[model samples]
Target: MIRIPTLRHVATRSLRCAARGAVQQRRWAQVHDVRFLTTQPSQAILEKYREKLSKKASQEGHGSIDDLKAAYSEKIQEQRKKDSTEGTPVSQPNAPSSFPPSKPAPKKASSSGEKPAIKPLGDILDLEKVAELPEKELTAIWRLRHASSPQTLCAVIPAPAYQAMESLARSNPYFVLPVPHESQGAEMHFMQWTFDPASKTSTVLFTQLAEYKARGEFAQPHTTVTHHLDLIKDKGLVLMQGQVMEGRNVQPDHAKWLVMCLQRFYGGWEQKGDELDGQRKERAEERQKLLEWFTNGDPRFSVEKLLEEAERMG
Candidate 1:
């Protein structure tokens, strides 16, 4: 219902904020997959905007959003050209559209001879086992599972799709999502993705603008939620983690709700998504073509191995 995929370009995420610093009558709420904490740490949101300038856009624009984007886009293209010229095998970039990585360690690959083949993600991966896979294996599995799923923002994207995402992210870096369920607290949230090239990780920030000024003398937006995303070492598996920054009497249910909303957001994009019959038909046709291609022994995806992995794990 949140339609988070509407701003699917950079895979924008929720934010974690610092709740303890405030003397006002507000509390903090944090949400993450593997961990939870009540003491609000301002690390997430503040870190993202640390580089933001306070003045009008500069022509020289050192550290300007547009400048940073142009530089990154050029660098991305350069990397692609380098890969092509040097005959580099396609892999996930060091910084995938500016995302990060983290989470529980995945299972170490075990030696097995007669493992079953891997299946599509819709077949339902053992989220637990999958979570424990080594970064490289996890990334490979992510690609194998979701490579052709329409509208997903995944690592190992096609050149064209990656370019499109870059264009969208650079041109419009943030998304303002209207939240009906959260309207009583805040009408809309300002969501942005901070891609850190230095650390090769990305952070998603969700800020709820306080309708009125804060209770303190210096007024500020009431809520800030932050999430950190990372790509597995080389294969580029994504790790989605978050912590809530502000709220009152927040319960564990709130964290669950936030996670579900984010999961749905990454599931789709565009208004129609894959809802229409025509779109579904087209998707099915394309998938069939891929199946045919793989059936004939396409080397792109180690289909057999993936199937083996899927079957072994599932």
Candidate 2:
């Protein structure tokens, strides 16, 4: 029994020594592997790996989660302070509740037919109020409102009247001018039609006849003959009454009416002259026919006649 106990004690001591030796050998092998597996890793490699792990932790909302929560709390507190300073109500998020709630997806619009909206110029300009303004004010208003066509006479009148005048002015370019002295007391205001080189059209500007009389200039009635003669000499044609002025046999009534229309159409800026050519000569002939129509009320010499003449000229 004494031999047996001694042998067991020796065996236990040997086993413990072997186990310790094996553990030390394994640890030595692990250290060796780390030092020179293939090539020794540099200090930079270890540092890079550590940095990558830190970045991954941060992106996964683990490393900086506390920091982010603190930042958000600070932001909310700052917003509350701003709202308090501005005297505005600050909306707060509600705390999570146990009650169940239903959510619905947004609905799309129907693809069925739908008309677009329309807006008119009259609706754009309050015509009654505009008409009440003086000419200078009216011009300024037009300049402010429609800068593209600022000098146009349509700026001063009512919507319907302006439309009519615009329609008339489109076909003829007349200039706005004070009526000759001869028609100073006449009910109709007159403007001298002149050619505009820039626009290649005649234009006119008109206001109330009383407005001109109020200016207290040209107290005597002035003949339109000198005006027409000057226009013919300079521009070769006077655009008037929706007709080009050219040739002989221009009647006084027609001339007077043309001047009146011009005044009604323009605000008083004179235009340049038309380029004289064969086409102008034909236009002149047609103008003579319009004059004949104006004087005699002859249907034969009307616009249709002028159109026919234009066609023949073509």
lDDT (Cα atoms) of all candidates against the true structure: 0.32, 0.31
- The residue-by-residue lDDT of candidate 2 on 143-220, one tens digit each, is 343233211112233333333334444443322221112212112232322233422233332322333333312111
Candidate 2 ranges with C-alpha deviation above 4 Å? 1-141, 146-275, 306-314
Local lDDT at 168 for model 1? 45
For candidate 1, the 10 contiguous residues with the lowest summed lDDT are 30-39
Worst 10 residues of 2 by lDDT: 28-37
Predicted structure 2, TM vs. truth: 0.18
The lDDT leader among the candidates is 1
Q: Estimate each model's TM-score.
A: 0.30, 0.18
Model 2: per-residue Cα lDDT at residue 50: 60
